[model samples]
Target: MPLTPIDPRLDPGVSAALAAVAEREVDQVFFVACGGSLSIMHPAKFMLDQHSAALPSDVLNAAEFVARAPKRLTKQSLVVLCSMTGTTKETVAATKFAQSAGALTLVLTTDPASPLAEAGDHAIGFEAPYTTGVPIDAKNSNYARIYQLVLGLAKIFDGSDKLGALMDSLEALQPAIDRAHTHFAPLFADYAPRLAKKDVIYTMASGADYGAAYSFAICVLMEMQWINSHAIHANEFFHGPFEVLDENASFVLFKGLDSTRPLTERAETFLHRFGATENILVLDAAELDLSGIDAGLAGNLVPLIFFDTLWRFAYKIADLRDQEMLEARRYMKKLHDY
Candidate 1:
């Protein structure tokens, strides 16, 4: 099979999967994953809920899930577990637990032999064009692919052809991705101080970018920024934490050309509650010609461009530092030890 780049495959598969969901009789979905996959998996989950309204979705960290979310594996639940490597220990355990409770399991993975894959009743395989965790600053091919598949799945759910234009648009995006790298150099340099200086670094995203925001914040905390950067959902921002958004915090809001508009706008409104505007940065992204996208496909992808941009930003930040920065985490370490 020809290797599919993460960015391209994500939109289509997600649409297709969601389409499949709509055609079926599933009542709920449980996504168990870690790292990039975990982060990127969310928008699809949200879109799935938003589009079909047929099922409720949950994206959980593999480790905490197996131990705490026993409700996920009940007989009535339909479990969709994702782990890029297909070998995350917690994911594997969760799948087995879900199966034991009589739930049907669908596994999405890069490797078929992975424990998660083997445990699932049905498994789908995808390959990414780029590396996952090779170098400090490399792109996450799987993360990109998840976005593509999620969008594709959504389109499939709606049985619409709208996503085709966006799928076609992928070939043209390379130049933009390349151009983005060039412009990012200075921004990475500017944020380098936070990596080396801040007392507490927190990353926030409101609305649609919340997943990417949460995922990247965790990455920075675990990989480079080296602090407990909480990923605050914009809706929840006003509830309590908005009070803390001050000069001490660094916030980044993600933008995509969709419902994210209202989400980002609302997020901006809350930023002022804490006087976080001056210190805030909106991740820059150009709107693509997704006019051809199917309603199903749009939800899957709307969040992807932002996810890719944020990951790239995190990747560059890691690159600016020495090898010691990324040397800390190597794939799904003890998680898949089984």
Candidate 2:
């Protein structure tokens, strides 16, 4: 596969849409997607939660959302639908439902002509920089593309200087990711395949990293590695699910600048209570300087770097093995029942 393609298509498109819609305060934000799109929406949920505390992050599995959560819509209700192809059944339908409710709907997608994109008030499409020709695990360009839109929004809404410093931070951290992958590659050569074949790998993180932890383990690792993984919020880990911990299972966690060390520490103590399963803590070694950026913004970027880097590194490793290679309809068809 070629060097992982970076998506630049949605940069100006999404940035401009957000700039134009800057008038909307977005009283309520609903993130709607199914499968991988929902997974990737994790970062946006985290950022929106932190930046727009006034706007609650409600991630709905599009079908369940329209069925159960339907409410009177105001211009305040902002619905962001993510579907790389712009044809996923759930996303397309939900965008229509959200619109019917009178909520403002936006779409982030790869296909501008897709039915899903057409349903949105604004459609942000990430132009893939390149293509991976391999039949399996071949196309993952959109994941990064949609991610840039989120980071770009960070620049506009959260005041990250319009991706200037975020890009710099990513550039600086890219090397750190390269180094970490080099170190873990060989060690994980055997372990990755082993864990990938297991029944499940549980990823746990509290606060903002929760969505990322879920996305990395369940979405990226499981989807790419062809394994089973699920993410959990840290505080909720003790609600009795820990009883299932065992040697056959694997447990994964993320360590980054804004990560909640104590909750994870508590999880560790609880995991010891069960006495099984291997534990891996992926750390963000990226040393970002916050003196230049706002203190509140610093925490968000640190973990976001880990989120951006870990999935890419995992995909690269999977690429060498030609695994976790689900693409749009062909790939997700097997994974999703709908």
Candidate 3:
């Protein structure tokens, strides 16, 4: 079965809470999460960095945030935390830490009954689909919900009426994503057999698309498929990661319609020079016709477009390799009491 979008409407209370956050004049936003949830906040952080510089932000590892306890985390700080399970010990602890620091804490999770959700000053619990048989759907729905919440925050802070149109643009994103899947699945299927043979891969992206590349590499490939992979930033590619490009290297580059697209293109050029052109798979957001979305908004949506395209390839690769995306865990939640 094909994937469906999560509800685009923000819960009224959630919207009201965020509106109050905006009204309170939040100066710094700290996104605290671990693993994939942490990766999902990158785009939101990027948006703040690129567009709303006045509202500075940081993406903090939940445990690290609790350890360091940044001095700037105060009543004026808005801490956004999320846990898919709502029970990650570090995240739950971080939520308490943030609250204790007088920071406004917002949490997104699937289980309202869990500790993290219950600890938050404002919690929005999403309905996670039962994807026991459709692992991809689970991820897709989770990603979509994150998109709504993150971009909704962006909309509030950006202080532009443009976000009104952006909301509609986002609502239409699922159909565009479905179209991307339909167009790319055959090509991805053909490539998956060969890709599945590789022991390691390098995923690269610039600007907002890096969120998708990072998530796909760590969350899906490393954690799910047990594949060895590295997520590299395009601008940082030449710094040291370029040394790994042998003939057998697999490179996935996500290009987006942003100022940093040229940075990724340069990396792609380097990849072509160092390896076979076919060795580099480029997922460019510009190729996706996000027609009703504003150019700037579309640029921000690069992560979503990239994730939608790349994860489908990953799902295909997992299928060809007979790997269970949900079952093969090395140390994530498998430890007895870690």
Identify the candidate with maximal lDDT: 3
Q: Where is model 3 more than 4 Å wrong at Cα?
A: 1-10, 127-158
Evaluate residue 81 in candidate 1 and report its C-alpha lDDT on the 0 to 100 scale: 75
Over the stretch 215-328, how does candidate 3's per-residue lDDT look in tens digits?
Answer: 889988898898899789998999998998877788888888877889998998899898766567777676676766667667776677667677668778888889877676
Give TM-scores for every candidate, taking all chains together and pairing residue i with residue i.
0.73, 0.72, 0.88
Instruction: State which candidate has the highest TM-score.
Output: 3
Order the numbered candidates by TM-score, best leading. 3, 1, 2
| Candidate number that wins on TM-score, 1 or 3 | 3
Candidates ranked by lDDT, best first?
A: 3, 2, 1
Q: For model 2, how does the per-residue alpha-carbon lDDT over 66-91 read when each residue is reduced to its tens digit? A: 88865645667878788867888878
- Candidate 1 C-alpha lDDT tens digits along 5-25: 323444344434444444445
Is 1 or 3 the stronger prediction by lDDT? 3
